[model samples]
Target chain A: RAEAKLIDGKAIAADVREEVRVGVAQMKEKIGKVPGLAVVLVGERKDSQTYVNAKKKACAEAGIDSFGTDLPGDATEEEVLKVVADYNADPNVHGILVQLPMPDHIDEERVLGAISYEKDVDGFHPLNTGRLAQRGREPLFVPCTPRGCIELLERSGIEIAGKEAVVVGRSNVVGIPAAMLLQRRDATVTIVHSRTPNSEEIVRRADIVIAACGRMEMVKGSWLKPGAAVIDVGINAKDDPSKKLGYRLVGDADFESCKEVAGAITPVPGGVGPMTIAILLKNTMEGAMRAYGMM
Target chain B: RAEAKLIDGKAIAADVREEVRVGVAQMKEKIGKVPGLAVVLVGERKDSQTYVNAKKKACAEAGIDSFGTDLPGDATEEEVLKVVADYNADPNVHGILVQLPMPDHIDEERVLGAISYEKDVDGFHPLNTGRLAQRGREPLFVPCTPRGCIELLERSGIEIAGKEAVVVGRSNVVGIPAAMLLQRRDATVTIVHSRTPNSEEIVRRADIVIAACGRMEMVKGSWLKPGAAVIDVGINAKDDPSKKLGYRLVGDADFESCKEVAGAITPVPGGVGPMTIAILLKNTMEGAMRAYGMM
Candidate 1:
């Protein structure tokens, strides 16, 4: 059995970051200012904080200004909305990202909708999401995770057009967008979810499989077509006494066995994780360029 | 082979029209005004003119006021846009429908985008189109043709959720929206386009197949899963010396052969055609109710 070649999302993310850094530098020199991203956090979730810190750190390394607001866990939705409105009016803020898992009392949709579409680099805006589903009308920004998945496939020299791609989820942020993106690239796409019967039978015939259902290793070895390229986007915490945290992140794909037959596979934590932050930086830079009328 | 049940779209459309008529009278009594749909036709293309007339007649039968504008064949893009703006502001106009395939001279997208989404009966605007693809959020209007296809299945009492739906096209107008609508109803969906390889292989697995690829009789009997319910949205003109105009209408599905293996199916010309007009009337009435704060 052939061990599938691992797609090194880390190295690719590094390359993307380097390119964005260069672009940011040139934009700063030409426009007299650096690109800035403002990430608004409402709740005090530890994971959300960790993600925000990583985003701000990447922005700093890439020559982008990082601005953030840490609101109290019980902050009113109005308070959080006020912060978004402030950023929307700020000339220095090129992009606005409201970290998800907002306070339970807050209306997340209302807050995300309030961000100016021009500054909606997070690409969660309904209008931006709509643009991605549309052809010919360019979206302001593609959602980072799905964008990262496409980047992985392209950067790894995989052919997307005319391929049979199976997406095992129908989520707005990941699965739906990935299916739409693949279809845009001319791939014949299918979306199978919990409602789907014979999901395994359908998945077994795919040329490319994206497991993003968020279930832990629900897709097994037999679901793959021999030599098919697999991209696993799920990150679930599984108990692992061998790990320092007592739990380790595992992807939706059973990576150990899937890799045995897959032509190419991406590993759990390092695969899609780094690419997401990298693309966020890239989107911020693009947003800044569009804002400056620099293409 | 067992013959399939023919879905009676004409009779169903008549029923829908009657229901809309009753709704229109009740709204008139309550609000002192009926729903009004303004159809803006950019040029004098015969087919476009024919469609506009059909729509106006349908509106009249349903007790909805129908206003129309007929610009010259060579009207400038700005001229068409000005009319659209006028209708958008008119208090009486609850729905604004710009007849499609506007003279090649006009920018169709620009014109469609200018229509207020609230009055966008055609549902071609980027925002409305995006809303259709999304989950949780609702689109202001579903494109009539796609909406009609789902109506056919529902009226026929076919189950959508947990079924295998194959939509054979990706046109934003019909195919893509239809796929999204079925998926929203909990059916697993696969979309196949001209770029797809082995489309027949994929279509063969459908529990419900929607043929909208605009190819005459492209799908044959061999592609059907046993007892599949099929909705044909394609209307192609085929060369036929027997007809006065020397051409006849055909759907994407090979009806004679496909019906033999399917449990139910819709015919060309009378099937999706009447339903589109019926749905348009329904949408306009609903739009008026929403605008009038009656809903």
Candidate 2:
């Protein structure tokens, strides 16, 4: 048995935040302005609220300006769109992000699409997503989680070019975009989901695996091609009364067992989670930089 | 060995073309004007000219007006973009497609992006492509070959939902779009490309397979999972001095051997090729119908 390397997402995210902090300072000094991000939160789902709060806090730490608006749970899509329109028109706001899982009454796509594409920092905009998948075309913003995964891989000193990579899920936000990113990097990529009859067999042959299917512990240790690098993007809450909250967060992979066979692995909570926030801030800063033609 | 059923793409395409013809006629009778498709050909390549002619002829058969112009091979990108802008403004034009493989002097994306998203019949525009990958959003047009692949499967009564489908390639035009389409149909899909280590092994487990890698005879019969349905989209020119043309067309799959083991398969010359033009006409008609609020 051999020891596996832990891909410390928190440490890598710290590196990114530091870079953004310095970059933000330089932009402010040279251009007399700092990057600014605006988030519109509709409905107060506890989880979504917590995520939004973290984003605002990250903006502060990275020397970027943050502005946000909170709408009631019963807010109409029109109301949300109105708030987004204001942010979209604000020249000071370099990036506009409407928090996801808005109340069911809201048409999420219409609201998201209404945000001017230039200010779509979340990278959920269709044009950006499609451009990211294209060869030779640059997307304005790469979705945060997928961007975070690539950051982890590159910062870990692992070679991505010409490697065999498998993405377990095909969600537009993560899995699909992640596969596109991998392909752009010259990795031969594959995607598998619930319908896949031989997911385990397909995964066991990967040089690198990205698990974003949101199924808790679905990928078992036995599925790992020994020494495969695994990046788990799933965040599922499993009931564990041992903690005061009566639940604990787990990823798509069976962490403890899979780590034994994986050459490198990221932990559930501290891995992909922090990297996402870091990338969001990075996108916001980059968007500002591009707007100023400084980069 | 028992003989395998041939997936007669030509027949399936004929069915689609007929449907479009009826749909177009109804539109003309009800609205007093037929849908129109405009093809902008910038070069004099014999193959590109032939393809353009085929598309115009299909448009005529389907009762859709065909518009085009043959520009010199040395046409500037600005010149091509100006032409696209004119078509974009013309109310009569419903679908605008720029013939691909434009002279090296012209930038494809610049010209394609110039077309109004509403009139982008090629579906190569970033917004349409991005929308296709999106879950709830329906794209105005899907890239023809990928759309044709789905049509072939649906017309033949092969179920896609909850099936294992493997797409061999990840090109933006065919491979990537095909994978997304299959996913939308509830097929668990995997994509394998040049960098894939075990493309054959991964593909062999599929209930359906789409080979769009453009490599001649890359898929072998030895790689088939018995009874798998195969769609061959590759169009490669292999040297064959036996003919006046000096080369013959072949697909990514080694058809003879694969068909022997597969439950059903499409032939190289007659399969996906005919379906592409058929889908293009279908898209043009549908786009016009949507514009008139008829569909």
Candidate 3:
């Protein structure tokens, strides 16, 4: 049986962070300025807090300035909007990210829409998203997760242009934008969602498969074409009695089985997870350079 | 030979126009206001003039107000922007359309972007385009041609959801947006462009096919899946000495051959062409309703 080459997203993401660190240092040297990112957290979800902490730590390590606004879970939508507006007007803040899954009272779309597109590091702003979708138009920023997925593919030397690529989700965050990016790179891209009747057959024909449907082990070895490159963006938790936490993280692809068929594949924990913050730092640095008229 | 049922876009477009005309009349009777569409033409291209004239005629027949701004071929970019800005501010103008392919000197994007998204009946604004692409998000308006394609499909009782839809082109105006619209309707969508090496195989797998590649007879009858619904959006001129004009219009699909295999197909000149202006008028009426707080 042929074993698949591991697409080490952790290592690639580290390299990207190092590049951003260097870029940040050089920008500081050239203009006495460092990129600033403002993270707005509106709730107290444990998962959200952990993700926010990781992002803040990553920013510090990259020599980027980090700004935070912590609002009570019950805060008013106006309060969230005020904070976002302040960041939009702040000269030091090159990027603004409103943490997702905000309190129920907060209208996520309205808050995200309020962010200045130039500082919309998360790329949730529709203007950035629209530009990204259009041919010959350049977006100020792309959402981090999908950008990370593309980085993983390109760094692993996977060819995209003229290839058959299928994205197994239609999420605005990952699947949709990832398909857009792949199509922009000249790949014939298909998006199969929950409603798709022949998704497995479609997956079997792809040279590249992006599994972001958030289903546990949805993509199996039998679903892939031999030698296909698989980038699994799904990170679902499966219960495991043997594990200390009583659970194990698994990607949408059934790793144990898919490895035998895929030419290369990314593991769940060590894959797309680390790449998000790394790309955020990169987007922040780029935003700073644009703000300073240096790039 | 079993000939495919003609989709009859001409009749369907006429129905849409009639709907818009009634809506406009109702609004006028109820609120003493009719929808207004502003056509901004920057160059003296004959084709553009003809299109502008047709739009104006359509507006008059529908009892909608039409406004025009004509500039020379050498019009400055600033001059065009100013015209768009004026229309954006005019309360009477519910929709603004900048005739495309402006002179080489003008920045088309800047002019298009200047139109307020609220009045962007043409749906070329990046905001509208982006909203159309994002899941769970709605655009103020959809582009005319792509919207017309979907209308043709639905009006013909063709089921879209859960179907395999292959859009053969990646143009921002037609192909990209059409794919977005199809996916929105729950179809598993694939977009194949010039760079797609296996375009025919992909097309052969589709339950529905949208041919907007602008290549004359590029999609052969052999390339289609039997019973696939085909909507041809391409209009190309083929030299025909038999025609009075020395040329005849054709679509990307070879109509004579495709009719044998397709379940239903739209003809070249009588097809998607009439649908564009019809959709534009419909969009203008909707924009007016939105402005007047009617819808």
Candidate 4:
């Protein structure tokens, strides 16, 4: 059997970022303004800080302004909500994103709901999510990771309409939204989550498979249909004495084995990870355009 | 093969209506108040009028107060929105239902969006729909027909968890919400729509099938898996000289053939149709209870 072609999410994401960069420049030339993203971090979690820094760096590289608000872990829900309200009213901020997994003291839904749906770049607001799920309606912004997954397929010239697609997992962030997006594209989409039985048998029948259950290498090559297109969204740390970091990142699907049978696949580290921030930039730009009546 | 047991939606709906009647009576005795539903009608469409009358009659039977607003066909968009705003502020009105397909001049989305999500018993508001689609979030109200379909399944003691359920069609009111509802119940759900190339083959793999495509007798016995439970939401009119009205109502499934192959199924006129109004009353009652702190 021929080896599967790599989906090259890194390159596709770079292309997306470049497009946003150009769009940002055009907006600057036309309106004398640049799109701005306001990111609110509630706690001092190391992982959240790292993600915030990466997003700010990406904004700088793309010629978009970035605003940051760091709150204490013990911040009151009202305090956090005030920050969101401030950002919501700031004309300079085209997008507002609240970093997730805040301290147990805060209500995430209340905080996310506080962000204006117009500037909800993370697309975590129920209004944006509902619009995305409904037919004849369009969300102002799609959740970044799921949008990136669809971008990978469309950029790779993979057909979605009328195809059988299976999404493994039902997380609100990635799996559920990804399934909804695929269904919107006219694919016969099925979602198999942790509670699902016979998931492997269901997956083997798909023309396109999205593995996002957060389990490391759970989808083996034997579980895939021959010539299926696979996109692995999971990034789990696996112990590897051979690496300097003492652990290596792997996806939900075993790439080495899956690449031999699948017609196309995306690898872990450089795949969906890069695309998320790129799509965030795109969403920010779009938000700015819509605000300025330039869309 | 044994014939499939009929899912008696009329009897179940009667039970639900009785429950609502008792609840309404209790509320009246406890607080000297009854649930009130405001029905808004614009234009003179015969079908819309018929539906509105049926809804009011149902409310009366359930011991709930009914409110009505009738407007000319040429009513302005602002007029419709003003009516919704009035109902939103009315403490007596717990649920506001705007009859659909208003004159082409009025924007339906704008009118629907104007209703407070709390009083949106129709569940057509994007926020409610979005909440329904999201995991761990709850909608104040779910759309009537789709909710009815689930009520039938639950009342019939069908296990939804860990099952392979297929939803046919993707309409905003029925198909999309129904699919989301099924997925919420932990069913591995597949949605096959008009654009799907092999819908029949896909439907054949389901343990539970919800046919809502509005196509008459489109799903044949051959298209179903043996013993698969079927809920036919489609109610199409077919000419029949033998019938008193010179026409007869049939579902999306071929009843004779499907009954022989299926484990359980809902009939056309006596099935999902009755449950829709029943659920509406239930939702209205729940909304009133929430307002009174009874729930």
lDDT of 2 by residue, B113-212 (tens): 7889898888998889889887678888899999999999898889999888999988888988998899889887777878777788888878999998
* Ranked candidates (DockQ, high to low): 3, 4, 1, 2
Q: List model 3 lDDT by residue over A63-155, tens digit each.
A: 999999999999999999999999999999999999998887778888998999999999999889999999999999999999999999999
Which candidate has the top score in DockQ?
Answer: 3
Candidate 1: Cα lDDT at A95 = 95
Q: Looking at model 4, give its docking quality level.
A: high
| Worst-scoring 10-residue span by lDDT in model 3 chain B | B103-112
Cα error, candidate 2, residue A121 (Å): 1.8
Residues B28-97, candidate 3: write the lDDT tens digits: 8999999999999987899999999999999999999999999998889998898889888899999999
| Candidate no. 3 TM-score | 0.99
* Candidate 4 segments whose C-alpha is farther than 4 A from its true place: none
True-vs-predicted CA distance for residue B70, candidate 3, Å: 0.6
lDDT agreement with native, every candidate:
0.91, 0.89, 0.94, 0.94
Candidate 4 chain B lowest-lDDT run of ten: B107-116
- Per-prediction DockQ, in order? 0.75, 0.59, 0.93, 0.89
TM-score of every prediction relative to native: 0.97, 0.93, 0.99, 0.99
User: Residue pairs in steric clash, candidate 4?
Assistant: A130-B130
As for DockQ, the candidate ahead, 1 or 3, is: 3
Write down the lDDT that model 4 would get.
0.94
| Candidate no. 4 TM-score | 0.99
The list of candidate 1 runs beyond 4 A from truth reads A74-78, B73-78
How far out, in Å, is residue B227 in model 3? 0.8
